[model samples]
Target chain A: MIIQREAVLLFAGLAVVLAVATAIGWTLKRFLAEGAPHPTIDNLNARINAWWVMVVVIGLGAALGRTALVVLFALVSFFALREFLTLAPTRRGDHLALSFAFFFVLPVQYYLVAIEWYGLFAIFVPVYVFLALPILAALRSDITRFLERTAVVQWGVMISVYCISHVPALLMLQIPRYEGRSLLLVLFLLAVVQASDVLQYVCGKLFGRRKVAPQLSPSKTLAGLVGGAASAIALGAALGRLTPFGVVGAAGIAAVIVAMGFLGGLVMSAIKRDLGVKDWGAMIEGHGGMLDRLDSVCFAAPVFFHLTRYFYT
Target chain B: MRLLPQLLGKAVTGLMRLLTGAQARWVGCGPAPTQRIYFANHTSHGDFVLIWTCLPPSLRAMTRPVAGADYWLAGGLRRYLITNVLNGVLIDRDKATRTRDPIEVILAALGEGWSLIVFPEGTRNVGAELLPFRSGIYHVARQRPEVELVPVWIDNLNRVLPKGDVLPVPLLCSATFGTPTRLREGEGKDAFLARLCRAILALRPA
Candidate 1:
């Protein structure tokens, strides 16, 4: 088979789950909410519909081989960066530098990852872009809020570009007995993390009583986090065939991914609060924005990449 | 054939939407195809482009951006973009050199059933508030009281691609299309322009 059997199984499993979810969402909308509008049900259905599109796109990328997957992620990084920077406060002085970040720095980082130039991809944004862009901003000579501008541009590149690139960088890992199956690592990380997110939302909507952090995210609860992480850990253990890790090892890493993904959500929520906006933009119908979808992955990808590189590679 | 220019036009408009998001919030009105004079505050040169980009394709084809002949006809690329791609109406801003009255030219476009996107501020205002609207808008409204006057507020464009900048910072800009206003029965020139300016300002994102 051109694609791994496990990957094909994962795709089929996702399609069936989404189909059932769509059915349930439709039944709930049709029967439960006869008079008053149901916000939660409508939101769930919209999310599920969007998930169908996303799953198909990712599945296609996985089937098309590594270059296609890398290119797909490159476009994801582009949209994610756009959403992050759109809400971020910037000045006219930052135009040239900002252009460099978008046009030059973003593509170069992805290119380095595609070519597996690990030495440069790891530090391109953190070292070179961090050092150089501020110089360009400084040259414009608008010193009002200079420090904030510099920090934000650097942070956007880091979170949106550098960190998100780590997902594709997983393909560059040299693990024994994992030849021609590196795509599965990405599939595994995505499945575990995203399942954790969905589980958290479902658990929160149903059994959640105690708020995890009422101020950071109103929707999250302690019950949601605990229930979701436990389920995702079980899921990861079951999918051990996809990874170099055994069931226990996969379960441990799933725990780490869930924790990091939770932190990533909180941090991004705090940023939205600071920006005084709901969601990043109207890019996505119900999911808020690209950044909203990728926030968990942004925080989890780098740690997962490094962990796999250190322990298994 | 002008096929290349038309294709380039689509690509450039798409690029503009991609950069600024050019989201049209039809708060006070729907995006119905009607003969309306869409007026907005002038900040950057991209103001009308953003407004034009926000229109529905049905309205976009009939919408003509009102620009100054002095600028659009200044050179090669700008002239080509303004004429072929945007299909803009070049008004003679200079009273001294213009043979045709700017209001007549605008009314002519309206007579031909084309909607016009006009920046009523006469010139770009880089300050905190809008400049006093040029009386040309009031004249257009007076002449064509039948045509609806939609006040559009283009937010954050100056911050995105302000004057003297070639590349934009890719900020999220929105064009808030307020309820269509018309010159009242007894409204004077200054009063009508003031009402229009206030309407545009009211739509600014809080």
Candidate 2:
């Protein structure tokens, strides 16, 4: 009987979310059709389509069981890490460090979250993985590009493995009044973060009067950033019950995520720009790379994870 | 299970195309025939992928590659990928004593109406000059005189993705299909192998 009630709630929750997403997507679809950069607009639509598929898959997994959902997120982190390293300049000396980062650190980070080891989960990547990887790389003694290579591996490990894993770590939270509603929290975070990206693209196309960083990232605009971040905060507060937060608290958290997400996107864009490439890898047609999709999550995940743990836990 | 593997395949192929923009050309797909032995000079790891990705999907089904058994058969994942994903025929090249005949294995694959890709240089060369041809190509061709011996020249593969590198940087590579040649009656093994090597070298752009 409880399962049936949960099922009905989940279905209702999903229908509402999907309907809203579709409406927003439809609005953007119509808006893009009017007068947008043809290629980037097409790419944005394709990214939205891919998001729809990913959301459905994860949603179904969550409805099935918590473990399934955790495992799905784990696989996504693995792919994102793979995409990151595939582009990063690597050396033979970095192989062991890279392997350890992928096989050990990634699994352990998620396992910590899965078991609700909050404190260790929060610091594992930044503190431990960051220190250990360079030591392993330096052990090779082929110090040609030693500092640069170690930094590259360390950065990839942090951004791809350690940071992104926190999003799934959200599942282990035990929020009051939201027992077994962790999936909804996941949805809320994803919806706000992804909606921000989609809306930023929409606004950038519609009324991007001022450039945010003409040299750094030409696509980003100050107008788009403000508009998108505002909408995300508004949506975040509206879905505050999804977390252990009230409306005002939720807005505060969303504001943090928006700022962090912008920084994350900028930093990753700078990295790609330095590497002299457009996209990280072409896994998704419209989206640039795995890093491109996960850039916002890299920043948003850790902040959200820590905030929820600090107050709720 | 099947659907998952198919999706993985598509995802992997898509990833490859994404990293390296798809710049494939199918100008000369040569008519469907019973069997043909493709001999090409290998410069990089991209040689196999370039050739395999270039062939028609239908023809790829029956085509098998002669990969070094020591490397391809090293572990379960590699074995599964070579035999299942790529449908390769592994050959042991480091036997100190006489073992199972390699020619018989390749002949059997061709006899089953499967086309095979062979690297006559036997090993990857870091330089532009074609490595010395091995006797394996002559032996395989001598046994299957009926099969068309097509000499393929893969240019700029080494520059696209060098050997022993995990990441493949995007660069244009062209696989030139030279006119098919066959072993003449009473031709010596060294002469035939050299001619085959030269036929491939002839196709490289100046």
Candidate 3:
């Protein structure tokens, strides 16, 4: 009974999001017909199209139950980690460490989450993989930039795999009353984070004047941050029944996610600047790559997971 | 039987893309079915495979990698891959006297309307720097003057799978194909080789 109710809710929610996206896309198309189409508008349309596909995939995964959902997110983690490590400069000495990170560490991390092995999942990458990767590099005997190379690969695994895994790990939360509806928590987190991102982009395009960090991210603006966060907070409050958090609690948590999401984009932008690449990869049409789409989720996942685990569960 | 090689090609292609995240950029000229020599920098064992897999499927069928006879023919899986899967042109790199001219073998492959992928450095370098050309490229160009010589600069391959590494790290690599060059009349061997080297080097990402 609970599963049927959840499935209906998931589909209905997806339909609403899709309808809104189509309307926005239609309006943008009409607007684009009027003028010499702006690059930002084209990019906006592309992102909206990508969002429709993402929503369909997620909705389908949610309908299929836990295993599919976990597998879907695991694939996302794989792509995100691939994007992250591709840009970061790693030497030959780090090859074994990286092979292990991709082949061994990432899968193991996701497996732990799937099996609900919380203790190992939390520290596998951070503690064991982190120490082991440097030692692997050291074994190659290439001491030049040893510490820097090791740290970069370790950080990539931590952020892309370990942190992103927590998003799906929401499914395993053993809340007293929550029971089978834990997937709702995952949906709530994704909804708030992605909503914040989209709203921020829309706001920035319309009212952006003062850049937040010109050096790091020219697209980010103070106006967009405030307006987007406020809108997302309202949205989260409105959808509060979906999660264990009530209206006020949901709003507060949404604000935290928004702030972290903003910071996540900034930090990733900084890393891109350091690497001297505009986008992470060219996989997602106009959205850059998987990492670009998930930067916020990567940062917010662990925080939201821990918060929900502590407070609600 | 035919399906096996096709599946193997695709699997190898997928693996190369997954491991290196290789992006193929035809900067100067778009991919065409014309006979051409894709000369690139050799950095790892995976260099030829990376370049080979990056080609469009239509072009990939007609292209063969020029590999070292000593290494690719060492037997077992390497031999099977080079002979059956890739249809690679193996040349003796060490014994210039005992073996037939590697250039003749490549030229014969070219004569059959097949394109060839050659590493002008002749050997893989451990560092990022491009090693000096080994005269094989110049000789090929002189013989097949009409054949386009496309310079491909493969970046980050050294770091992905350097010398003596059995496994490859999943790193982003790119193969930038520059404007095709040909051997000029009255050009000295040294001068032509230098020019060819410069063309490949120019395609490196800033």
- In order of appearance, the predictions have TM-scores of 0.97, 0.71, 0.94
Arrange candidates by lDDT, descending: 1, 3, 2
lDDT of 2 by residue, A91-208 (tens): 6667668767777888898888678787898788889988998898888787888989888888887888788777778878887766776666676677778778877877887789
Q: Write the per-residue lDDT of candidate 1 for residues B1-206, one digit (tens) a residue.
A: 37898798788889888788788899999998988989998899898889888987778889999999999999999999999989999999888888999999999999999999999889989998999888998888888999999989888888777888777766778899999989999999989888998999999888
Q: Which parts of model 3 have CA positions greater than 4 angstroms off? A: A1-38, B96-99
Q: Model 2: per-residue lDDT, tens digit, B86-160? A: 778878787674377777777778878899889988888888688899898788778778788877777555644
> For each of the candidates, what fraction of the native contacts does it recover?
0.65, 0.00, 0.82
Q: What tier of docking accuracy does candidate 3 attain?
A: medium
| C-alpha lDDT (0 to 100) for residue B87 of candidate 2 | 72
Model 3's DockQ score: 0.66
Model 1 stretches with alpha carbons more than 4 Å out? none
lDDT of each: 0.89, 0.74, 0.86
TM-score of chain B of each: 0.97, 0.87, 0.96
Q: Just chain B of model 1: what TM-score? A: 0.97
Q: After superposition, how far is residue A204 of candidate 2 from its true place, in Å?
A: 0.8
lDDT: worst 10-residue window of model 2 chain B:
B19-28
